[model samples]
Target: MGLSGESQAAYHYTTTRCEWEFYIIVTHTSGPTGRRVLSDKHKERRVGDSREMVELITSNPSALGSLVTCDESWIYCYDPETKRQSSQWKQFDFPQTQKGQAEPELFKSGRWHLHQDNAPVHSSILVTNYLTEMGVKAVPHPPYSPDLVPCNFWLFLKLKENLRGSRFEDIEEMKEAVTRVLDIFTLEDYEGACKKWLECYNKCTEVGGSYCKGN
Candidate 1:
């Protein structure tokens, strides 16, 4: 069947009909998770939430004054001055630490709201109860939606850029370096990040929540 779609398939498939078996396997078994794929329902939630955020900000420019975001990530660390210069990446995945449990004093002193994602840790009853007890609010984030998180679009980008190629002895030294970098950012920088958040929400709503990341 030279004229057939099956016959005209890629050479790899033609060689062994291997892709057909792969397709069957894929259909039968769940695939490994890597990148998140947003569903239509997620898009709906993102759009609605984004609109609310825009309106909230529009009605009150200071609405995001206490907003926070997910700022955790793997950072490469090394010290150029020592033999420990071999790259050692530190993975910060402590759910409790991320939810401010580690900084209970700060959260207790003042109300805090987080634009946190719907990860299992963030949504856990423990963290929720803690926030409620601390008089802090948790903004509802659409599932699988990171584009709306300001930290993703702004803070981390700038933070990593400033940290790139810089070396530090250990996690403590790296943490200090990160703090130093953050200290240099002016109020305008923070305001700009907030503005970018608003822009992202606007874009999300504009595109019916189907917008691309980093837009």
Candidate 2:
């Protein structure tokens, strides 16, 4: 809900490796803070795209667990969730994997989709071309659809809630606060996130993609 500062700008990129593995990338930027109002066109697209996601998840159930998604959020000096993030990592490790499954490398060339928001930083022609050249399948995220992303609907909110009201002396202090919150997350936390992710998607489809709570 609320952040701790207004002097610094923080952007977070969250990559969910599996049902229980994920990490965050933080970037600092200079900008304003506020909510984004989606146009009618964007709202329609959110409904259609989320419905497609619902179909994918319903048929496979473990579909998202198999795919790695990336999205950025704006962390104002006070709020650290919005649209300042990127997707350019080589590989990552997971805290845990599904039983009987080998650890997954999200970028095994065509094994995972690179889900990015339509932020200017993410949508640059260079970025698009790079993804195309690398044969990376891009997962489409409708604008103003954080309700469908786990980090937005769950992880970021958890961080804000835990880190709220604390005063960070510097960047290092803020980092420590964030890491503290992350380290305390357990298997149940991540599993719960996956459940919430799908439930939100279902609600999105039900509401015709307007706005759903608890997503």
> Each candidate: what lDDT?
0.56, 0.60
Worst 10 residues of 2 by lDDT: 81-90
Q: Write the per-residue lDDT of candidate 1 for residues 1-215, one digit (tens) a residue.
A: 01233212211001011100000010111223233677888789989998888887788755776555553344456312223423555443322112111333334446445667776656788888987887676677787776776655666567666666666554455655565555565667767777887888899898887866555
- Identify the leading candidate in terms of TM-score: 2
lDDT of 2 by residue, 1-215 (tens): 12345544443323333423333434344334334676778778988887877777678855766656554444333443232322322232324322344444554434555555666667888889988898867766787666777766787777666654455666666665675566567767777887777787777777776787544
- The Cα RMSD in angstroms, rounded to one decimal, for candidate 1 relative to the true structure is 17.6
Worst 10 residues of 1 by lDDT: 17-26
Model 2 lDDT, residue 37, Cα: 78
Question: Which candidate leads in lDDT?
Answer: 2
Model 2 regions lying over 4 Å from their true place = 1-39, 74-104, 213-215
